[model samples]
Target: MCTFHGQPCTYLRGPLPRKRRKATDPPEYRSQPNGSGSGSVPGMTHLNLNYPHGLNMTIPLDHHDEVEYPSPELLEALSPSLAGSENLGPAHRQPSLLDGTLGLHLKTHSEYVGLTNYREPCLLDLHPPEDPHTRSVRRLDDFTIFMIHRDRETTSETQRIADLDAIEKVVHPLGASLVNLYFRIVHPSFPILHKKVFLEKYARSYHEFSPPLLAAVYLLALDWSIFDRTLSTSSWQPDQSRLEALALRTMNDDMKRPKISTLQAGLLIQQRAKNNTWTFTSQLIALSHGLGLHVDCSDWAIPEWEKGLRRRLAWALFMQDKWGALVHGKPCLIRPDEDWDVRPCRIEDFPENAADEEHDPEGSAEVVIGRELFLRHIELSLILSDVLRTFYTAKATRRNGTLEQIGTIGVAELAKPIVLMLRDWYAALPEALQLQGTRMKKLSANGSLHLSYTAIDLALHRALLRNVSAVAPPELRHAIRMGARTRLVSAMTIISNLQPEHTQSFWGFMASAQLASIGTFAGLLWATSDDDLEATFYCERVEEYLWSLRVRSQAVPFARDALRMLEAEVGGLGPVRASNLPMEMMRI
Candidate 1:
């Protein structure tokens, strides 16, 4: 009974009353550790009584049967919370529970909590905040601060300080001669760079110009400079490898912040670097897109010169992508439908130098010689792009069916329109750009124009070669074989007439590879032809062409190897057919 609630209360000075036990109960429950008799109270049962150190007891009761108590040993196993918790008295001791549980609440907020939940260390701030007064006080004055800021702005500029003294020392007084050589030799095939603007910029500090462009100009000029006694007899000739490395390094550095000058530099590097043209051209395409060069700028409020530059640069990239596809056997990157509305370039786009009467607006020389070849080249490239889309693209091939379908009848059907377009393109070429006999140099732009035309024709007809043996209707097979033979003969004749010395004048890698491919194709044609007279004629002509290649440039080892292989196959003048030739010999 409770006394505070005014209920009856019973007070006991000793332990609580125990339950009464029957006679059959265990003796251990009746006897206490002090040897005194204490019976179990009602509603309680003594389950066990064991004494090892002090006292250990187990009681079973009717009311609370599920109560649990841990051993004292487990209670003492906790880690220390404070430095001297182990030495603390029982009343003062506190348990140190494991982290990330109720024990976390026991620890101080600052001790357990962190700025972030992750276990990784915090990152150090590289650009920490500074006081405005500190920043202002560090400067000497307003003029000095302005100068520092100006220098910082200039650091982002693409133009770097070129060693003009070294350049002047190398070219000496023959600077004009080198410039002339570049325009005369390299500009015709690669008209992307404007000669008039280049000279105007060059008149200023050479340090202000892009290093890669200047290096490319110097390297290309060095080739023709060999023919000039003024530069050739100089104390020092420019090192080709060094200049190339410099141009490549500068191009790579400027690639991150690409500009129109950077694109021009890349094109120049592609022309000189033989193996990296495809890779560089692909990257250049991406860079062009980043600058919005793919979009038409006619409506933009830019200078007329800038608009012309954009058009030229855009077309140049288009041509690069197209020709790169043909040369590398890769897909074209620039799609006609997706490209911008940049119009065809005009003659006025190319600035005229006061001293050059040929560039006069009223002069016929400008039409005949200046920009005519470039415009024609662009037009032909457009046609080539159409041909690639119509026949070679993956979507077109899928639409036509499998490779077998394309090889059997699809190619012949597609070749009709492309061949007609090629014919029209050739007919429209200016008479000045036509490849005339001994009157023109073999490696002139005229020669390149004709070679491009022939190459496209060959590419179109080569698809039919595989169909010649397809199990198709007799009339269809005959037509395919006849068509292939005509194109092959025409390609062979065109290649045969090319003076090997003139090929050295060409700048692009594609032309050289195409020539080798033509030679290889002719060998396959000669081997496969049923007509002995025609086969012999082609065989003799190809052999002559291969010999010319072997002597003209050591760069084309493919030609040398192909010549040997072909000579081996036809050495005995034995009867050979396409099936007898190894598959390797038939590949371009």
Candidate 2:
């Protein structure tokens, strides 16, 4: 009966014969709106003769015990297909009489596969979510495409249920692809090669989307993956040649690109300064301990030089931290308290809401504070600290009879001059910056409070070295000078941390100001050459200071390293011409 073998079919249709009419309900009879025993609506009257004819003609007087209807066993003889039709598949074959009936072939497939049987729209019910992860991924993907294809289009949230269902299925599959997309393609540089590699290798076969479409999809996926670890520095083991090449490339880039404008550079410096305060202080302490050159305030006179250097380092760190906070849009913690003594004044008394500037000219001076100063200060501190460490170590040699005894008198003598320089420097500052009253009161309580430590250190060193006159034989003066030089080199290591913005400035200071100062002191020593004086005086200073600081445990080895370096430098000095040497040196 069914010619089209595999044609579509509906499962629930049939053409079975109609049931016979009963006495009370004849086949042609109908109940009207008013149920007046007539086949008609409320306003119409019509007779039901045809319907009653079937009921009246029903001569089913087969009351012969109902013919003892077929037993259950006899009814089982019928085909099983008709009996079990309800259990058939949606498109299962129907009885011959039901052929071609509408909906008989309708099929219900598993929802696991999304397409509907008719290829028409169908409702998909998903669970309510606490967080819209699926929704975000789907939206981001579409947004990316929208942004790329129609740059001017607005990202509205209006969407269809089918799109929502599709989003849930795609999120997990697209995670990594999206992350790589943002880092490589959407990144500011959009390096062509990185993009190509990202598309072909990283994101290829990702959801079978077009390459351009994939790029945007990936970016959206990546946004949710950000964490703090993304910004940290991991261990980097680089090949030597590769490292060298990169360095060279960087140098080339520097040469080709115009230098950062002053304003830009200043902003950057200020930013660095704000953050560097805490970082630098913590780092310096760690580095000092690691290098075996820590200072202990209890046992020995904290050399004025060390004191000044630390102050500089601390201040620089503070300024850097302040700058960082500014860049982060945070309230500055470095600002002074608001309560200050001023003549009684009222804004209302001024004309047109403008202040009377005649009384406040000094407050209007614009000052540009930048990281350059902090960087310089840090460099100087590091340089000086290294110098002091070496000096401390050399003086601490056991043969020198406990560096404390030998260096105490000298440290004390230099303290006065160092303090004097600090006082002068403080006095030179603008009166506005100079604190008065209780602030000065606080300074007396805390000796490390001011920026005058440099002076304190210079005076301390001068006196400490002078003590050598009483402690060491006159012949040892050259050795003491050598010890001082060794420490100077160690302290200069901060130069390594100087950023490009401050590099030239630092190097210039090194070659001119710093070197000049060291040279002047070196000339005062009896050692015949730079090498001799450094080996003896500078290294010795490091030893003595370390012993006094009680960090002598580590200082001894560092002192020895400096001594060795000094020896090598002096050893390489080819024979000096007799005429070119200091004239009186030959007589010695």
Candidate 3:
């Protein structure tokens, strides 16, 4: 078996045959005939122009297998001169004897040309004899040759070895503390890398992993370490800038041959970026495509572990593209039409260790803890992508006309189905993953899940507010206002309940911006309500939420900024109602 273009091929046994073509063969087998000439061969129904020499040949359409034949017009365009030539010869003829004049002239004139025993002077050294004791070199078979070349092309960084001494100096001292931080925080949200395989390789040798990925793991691990009381107090501090620099340098070096590690490193860098997170995420998507992460690997003859990793990474990137679009207010990169049929990830895909089995029943513990969270995240992301495609997309706006037009027709017509979908998603959540009655942790996967759920509701409610007005049937306008108000209250409640210490646990930058939008939207609702009692009630809840955010500013500074913005907007509010407010003010 051999691989071609990343797909497998098989060899079939055949015997070599000896045959010679005559110059007198039919015109169809020879060079193409000029215009109006009879070039058709007997028993042939179709003719194709063979490449390079404009040779016309009989290649019946029914007999053409696998390959797509070019059109006659295209063939003519490629070789107009040859096809139009009047004086044509048999295409299978060998080169003429008179082709090389210099060789013939030298042989005819030289005195020593016919003297076979005469030796010629030489400048280069004679070929060396092969060693008798050593194994003789044999010609490689076709499959072996292909395999060698493929390996050469795909292998990442064969020339340079990472500095083991330097890497060990950084990672070894942290011991299991770094690993704990990753599993507890990073892995729960972005489960791109396999923990068991990573730890197993790290234990064998720090050099076993790619330098960029190793450095990335340490960098992200250290970010979470600041939250760990014991680890934070240690006299020795990890150099985050140094690790990040090393990771970035190594990542650039390996750009020509991107591996799974390269994708993982890109994701880690994206998490840490303050300004260009979306730009970096887009670069990661391109790198992933280069690594064939966008192509479904289910049929590829790779290991089960690798297949699982590919599926996980592909989905992770898909989520990044979709969610990043929402966070940055940019168009999503991964369209449903362009994405491959990569399957949803499974629990068996993750590498297991003895520690994994200790949590619950032998067969299902991993599913209960990590896999469910990841699968649920994937499901929610898919819904979010659809939401963006439907309501938020430019195409949707052109079709639905302005927000007032959409509201005139009833925003609930578009929003009702999505609200049901969101409810169903929440309903289907596993008991362990549910937010209700669950004690929120500083970095709980369940808490992140709750935040995501609330974010979607906030996005939908904000969309409805785009055209909520008295002109749009009274009932529809009232429903839109009430829905927006209720969702705003719910979002504020979730944000207010989050403890100050847990602020860092939320996904960075994007989550902060999303929380800020929620607060701003709540302020808009409170400012626009006509009823004094209702306005006052929402005002107090908004103030309470702002107070909570103010106390948590040390952990979430963006939230603090959001609170200040909301206070300024609320302070300027008068009798001006939500229906009368500018559409821009109501926008999320």
Candidate 4:
């Protein structure tokens, strides 16, 4: 954090802009960052190309406003023949970028940088995280909000009492059971909070924790009351509205002095606040950057354990940003090239590990599986980022930030390397992570992990299908259609394997949104099929998936809703063909 007043700021002993890849590390992705020659973050260049402080909007409407309006010039580049004057050469062939904007240029990942926006309340560092508050506090509106302090109606001591009273009123008498339920069921899959640290603090006193965070913990745990037999049968239920209101109020106040707990609370409560999906996620990312969560903390002069916790939290947010973008049809808040610089997490980074299971009584084999599930999710988020970057970027398009793409890029060529990456990822997946067969009795991460893969693959294939044109290379169009179908069928396979146990896992928390996506994939296959026999096969499998959802309808949240979506998606597909031949679909 030391800066020379006379000169441009430089780290005396701090880590580099971002971490670089080492020789020992496996080269998972070969695509390199396109613009910057070196992988270093915008350290001095930002100073050289200095401009007024950047302002991030309080509302997540920046990307929303970047709608591309076609001018005559762009119209020609995207559809030259449509201009009625330009020649449709090899480069400007029909079914150009218009077919399906399928183009990818990738870059290899670098080493992990230290914390960028991490704000340690009291501790000072000789070599602190590279990204400090000064460096990341770019957005004017955000900084303005951060600076504004409201007039208080009461003294600090009185406010603290009031906050505690509010929390105590909402918290259950057997809050310990609820906390235990969270660790047992949810923590394994989503390890945003350090179990040891959280338990230690709660044991000391509820007041030891932030008000928002404390309320958030109990509130989230209550969602799974059924898991606790006693809580399930009890006549009393929590006042969810009150707890949520208190969390929201305290959350706003806590932002004045942000901490890791703030992020933990934000991520936990993200599920309940369905109305604020886009704005809330955007705010979380902004807060994280300001707190330096995006910076690598490998070389930070912090406790080794804290470093591990930081890495876990950082990746958790990373997963949130990538998935949120795809689900909401919004742009990702974090950028891989300049924004990310952390090393891939190792087994030691995760709080729960196999060796620790034997030492603690509460620790079980589930902890071991849960950590594996979490790590795998982080890896999948990396792949999903590439999918968004490679195929969905504005590299080939004329506009900088618009979603409306206009390019003549090779869609099939772009998919090959990513396709290989996905294949290798699945091949390298640990056998322990592989769950029981379809409809297996036990529930591990099998369904969530499998379905996640299907969703991402569907994204890749679906993009290709959109580019399918009569004038496009027949082979390319045919291949894209088949790949999409394969992904649709993959969705069915994952859906069939789902059990009641999965509904309680981390993925289960977001099941409603994901279930809608599954329906979309099935619908894409059903609506786009030119062949009647092939369409029938998709319809039958989708119906089977509907039946599966119906069986789990009572136990799972929004299962009935998903079932209805699938019914509407396939039922309204198109004119029903005469019941003639099932062989049209039976053929592989």
Candidate 5:
């Protein structure tokens, strides 16, 4: 059978033809939330403006062909809280500590771009099924043409490759150690690059790897250099700015002939907020579609290893899409009812069945829970993903403006499923993934995962508060209030537990500072929203987190800037300035 990406071409009933719309046909226009190509922020114009690549955004399949996930009932029955609040360590019992709060100065906005306005969306690049035009013949670009031959690159691509020759010197004597650091620390959380193939390829020659991928590896590793004994003591300190600039340039070049490596570089570099923007993320999602990573490949004619890799990368992209949309306050690119088709990741999909472990050459420490963190993080993303569709969507929020209009039982009923999902996620955590009394660790392998859970939980509880008050049903309001306090406490506990390992891990560059700021806000809101001694209790934890933020200020970018904003907002939050909270949330 004739196929594309090993699936039958459903429209190939006859030879290809080109036909235009007749005047009497139905209008084929619809609103594309955030997936359109345009310039609001990053340099999105030059990337996807005219790229003509086909994407199988939707498939007609039998009812039984759909994927499945655990039900809320099953999730709620999974396990109790791994770190039960009442039993939390001395931090919970001791008198509140107050050193003060910490702040960020990164300029993501250009003079031309406003931080609030979205680009004017025109039309979706996707082919509408009801379009009045007939399908045309397929076309290939030079990058794809050369990739099919297996032995060469296009001339322009070769020129692009030559531009990154300086990377060889950038790694110099520490290249191997940096790669090891990546596989050890960053890879476990991100896990985009496969261990065996990457190492095998590197053995052949540095050139065996794409400049973007190679450069991204060493660049991310540099963030964790202090943890590596060999490189930590060596006098060689590479210019991170030069490395960042090189990775960014090569990554943009890699996009010309978009491949798996292109997506890899994009995901890696974007881990740091300093290196990413909403525009850049949209470009990555577009490239992922161009490469056909969105479609299911379970039965494709590919190696078993490749199938697994594709699934992992697709889910990783999904996490990026959902989280990026939340953080960027942009429309979500992946619609659950539309373009998202990949199934939830399976255990077999990871490169290693047994979690990978790394013993530093110093023989100082070993960590193998990277897989646990990666898997659980995906689950957490799925948790927040539902919030995006259910309650936070523009349409959903607009509808929510009415107070429990009619048919629905209001916010409580609507929140039940998400509450159950979060419960099950926490309950199901393997022991290796659980935290105790917020114990600080030197590595904190699973720390980021739990910390992220607090961030997501805080978001949920905060949203619930708008619909709740003393007038709301007593039990319902109490539950939400108690839950919000719990999440704030959870966040405070984890924030103070911050370690170098956690800060330098995957997404460390941005997540550490951002989560800390979210926790501090949760505490402030708790302290002011209700009058009780409990406010002081929460404030003490906030102070502890602020102290941690101060200690890690140099290690984590934007830590102090985020704190300064919090202090300013707190200062201005007289009854007249409470409006600033939403702005701060959006900025964070």
Candidate 6:
């Protein structure tokens, strides 16, 4: 996909023979959503500006075959609060924390293009069916070639030998074709010695590629594999080691992006308030993952996709220094924030008179709801802080050649400072939330725990996004957006079901934060020690207590189910399975 005047587009390959199929056939396929569950609504689908005639489109069989499409009126009735939002406000004109010198001044315009925005997407001529159909035919710069063999059909051992032999036969041609494709996708800037080139050359001789190159190919394969599985509902399991290696490489790549000086990120937050596109701001909840935020809905027995979206959105808000409230008539921390040593600014504190994207005060109801959702986004940077520390430390150790033990005390030690920061923020909860007498009758009493847990989960979500985004190619940014959107939708749906009066109340925030925090701590603590027996005991007890507290247990099937899956995957004593323990200990 290419960014044209800041908008994104997927360029189709040159004109090909067109044989119209019957109307009953599925529509032509476009790109797939980067998430699962409750696929994108129709109206929101990208406008086919390039095809006035309207290109054919196809909905997945799982969703399309079984679920009826929403009627136009029904779609119109959807909560505008769910529409995507982007903070495309004008750039912050002020000096930022990271702006060390005048020369270091980063551009703050809507036109600003970061490394993430670099891609020229021209769709390839290859349109292989979801499954292996006819022989694969890929178009090279100079000629079209038929695949001698499908990579998927080969075993690892035979594939290695085949690749070695294949390199001797087609390496020179394959390398040239690859370079041509690379230039088509992105500008060519690196010297011949760049690792990317070296890796690509080595990729021809699959056995000769270094760990990083192999990891990149694995990640690309994973992305393709996941997309195929999601769209086709085919269960294709990848080697766990391959997934881990891919994740590690992606994390390292993310660190290389001119680190958005903390000051720059902060400035973007403030500037976004005044100049961002209404879509970005309104879509805050959905874009939470894109921004490396989290959502924690472990208390709820909701769809996994929804839960993950909410957690990420909450964390994104937290990262932007936009959550908190008054305690004892004094300022206090509501969501974790890095700007405040004690607490940070809340949504209510946003500059009221800042420029808005939709100048029309009387816009559609969807626009209004979108604005409201943006304002309600959870703000918790503590999650990102923890995630970064956790991922980097684990990665550093792994790079040192200790793959046998990935998560250990050394990793947990790296994570402790960030966790302590969260603890400190929780300690600053309002007097009502902390006091025994007031807690018995107020929202704080019932909701504080859940909110605390949600806060921590938001952090974890952010970390995971960071981990994935770090290694993902620029082409996969859409997937990242999908990931963030799914989480936002889930969180909003969960909150919408709550007592409307309490949805924005301190207790409400506290409840969500509490649930996320619990999940985060549970995961991290469990990640620390190698003793599966002990971890299982803790997980089971915690799960039981969380269920007992009526912490919206139905809102987060992803984390819960993943835990179960992980247990099954890991086998033996682990976070997934443990002797059913009492909820009593978890409360403490």
Per-residue lDDT over 210-316 for candidate 5, one digit per residue giving the tens place of the 0 to 100 score: 67788888898887787678789998887788888888887776666566777888888888766768899899998877566776655443334566677788888
What ranking emerges by TM-score with the best candidate at the front? 4, 5, 3, 1, 6, 2
Which residue pairs collide, candidate 3? none
Query: Model-by-model lDDT, in order?
Result: 0.54, 0.27, 0.56, 0.58, 0.56, 0.30
> How do the residues 16-73 of candidate 2 rate in per-residue lDDT, one tens digit apiece?
2233224475323321111222212222211122221111110111112221232334
Over 373-399, each residue of candidate 4 has an lDDT whose tens digit, in order, gives 788888888999988886665553224
**Model 2 misplaced stretches (Cα beyond 4 Å):** 1-236, 239-241, 261-423, 426-524, 528-565, 570-581, 584-588
Give residue 59's error in model 1 in angstroms. 99
lDDT over C-alpha atoms for residue 165 of model 5:
59
Pairs in steric clash, model 5: 102-563, 102-564, 103-560, 103-561, 103-562, 103-563, 103-564, 104-561, 104-562
Model 2 global lDDT (CA atoms, 0 to 1)? 0.27
Candidate 6 lands at a TM-score of 0.25
Residue 485 miss distance in model 4 (angstroms): 1.7
Candidate 5 lowest-lDDT run of ten = 100-109
Which portions of model 4 show Cα errors greater than 4 Å?
Answer: 1-157, 272-276, 355-365, 394-409, 437-443, 508-510, 531-541, 564-571, 576-588
Error of 2 at 532 (Å): 15
Model 4 clash count equals 24
- Model 3 stretches astray by more than 4 angstroms: 1-172, 226-233, 273-276, 353-367, 398-407, 436-443, 499-509, 526-541, 555-588
Per-residue lDDT of candidate 6, residues 101-149 (tens digit): 1101111100111124432212233344354331223222222221212
Q: What TM-score, computed on C-alpha atoms, does each candidate reach?
A: 0.64, 0.20, 0.66, 0.68, 0.67, 0.25
